[model samples]
Target: MGPPILSAVDLDKSYHSGSAELVVLRECSFALANNERVAIVGQSGVGKSTLLHLLAGLDRADSGEIRFGDRDVHAMGEIDLARFRNRHIGMVFQFYHLLPEFSARENVMMPLLIAGEATGAPARADELLAEVGLEERGHHFPSELSGGERQRVAIARALARGPEVVLADEPTGNLDHENGLRVMEVFERVHARHQTAMVLVTHNQELVSGFDRVLRMGPGGQLEQTDQEAPR
Candidate 1:
């Protein structure tokens, strides 16, 4: 309806291996409306993760413009970019990156602490942990949690700063079918509760049931809308 909450235009990215150049994205473009849920599906090496990284401002595009609402992400200085990312964007990787020594609640409180908002971080972290069905496990360390539980903790941490958008890369890649389903259920509950916009890069199509749209990334780094029942 209105301008997209997040958008990129004419993006291009490449890497150099030895004397050769490997192009990952070529003139790729994308958009996400406020509170929209989008799933990106593709074969491995199609630059799905690259696109996600670009969208999250984790990496800069060689040539492109990334805008989160009215802010130009790529144009910001390092300090401003880091602060912007900490406050506005959340990220979840395939591997749960929780600090080993910290309890689940402490891990979730990380973003708040980094942003200098530790005054009520503990209470906020507990609320997020509870939202993800880990209320009782707040005191447990990452090593003490199951694979599914760790991923849920990561999700809780991502939501700690009340980010407007969450960019997730293979959030359930390490889980079994049952665990994956549980994680998806948690995502659904979190979405309903917080209305956070999500852009998920996943190979598992079955986990994309309730997403607002499904995008298939081609080998050339172009994204095309795909049918819900599209062939795998």
Candidate 2:
């Protein structure tokens, strides 16, 4: 395998609860290979979401090094980081954060518009919606779509910029079993189609089955590969 597309080294983060320091991450390190799918599973409050946020540059580590290829993520200034994230990193949250007034295609076209690539934004959004099996729903608003369909739209929006890596925090956590399964199928198809590397943080062990690597985050912010079997 070649060098990782994204990586973190000796990461540390802490929050102050009154006078007490809540250490969320300590010496945490990770790496994501090109086009690889990695699942991070752990008990609640184990910093899984924290790690994802740090990787996506949504949050800062008290001290650490985050790298996307040769570029240091944390080292970038605000404007540069924002631009980098807009063009290179895609983020998906458990709750679909679609704009209430925008249609599905409009939501998918958001990143493209923000990046000043609006020349063909509509066509690109349509293509992505089609990829996620939502071609016919492009005219609908978030309120009109079901939970699963909303999530699929979020997924389509995430892939809008053709990002090198997607950091997803519990992408399937908000859905029922059937909808969750549908979302997972969409992920499988999207990964296969775009070859986008993904770091998925999920509490559901069953969701990790198709990933290339499964990592368990300990309460101390340590990450280790797990040999635990996923239910068939």
Model 1 TM-score, 2 decimals:
0.97
Tens-place lDDT digits, model 1, residues 1-232: 4578999898999989999999999999999999889999999998999999988888999999999998889999889999999999999888889999999999999999999999999999999999999999999999999999999999999999999899999999998999999998998888888888999988898899789889999976899999884322
Global lDDT of each candidate: 0.91, 0.92
TM-score of each: 0.97, 0.97
Candidate 2 local lDDT, 1-232, one digit each (tens): 5799999999999989889999989999999999999899888998998899889888899999999999999999999999999999988899989998999999999999999999999999999999889999999999999999999999999999999998888989999999999899999898888999999988887876988888999976899989864423
Off by over 4 Å in 2: 229-232
What is candidate 2's TM-score against the reference? 0.97
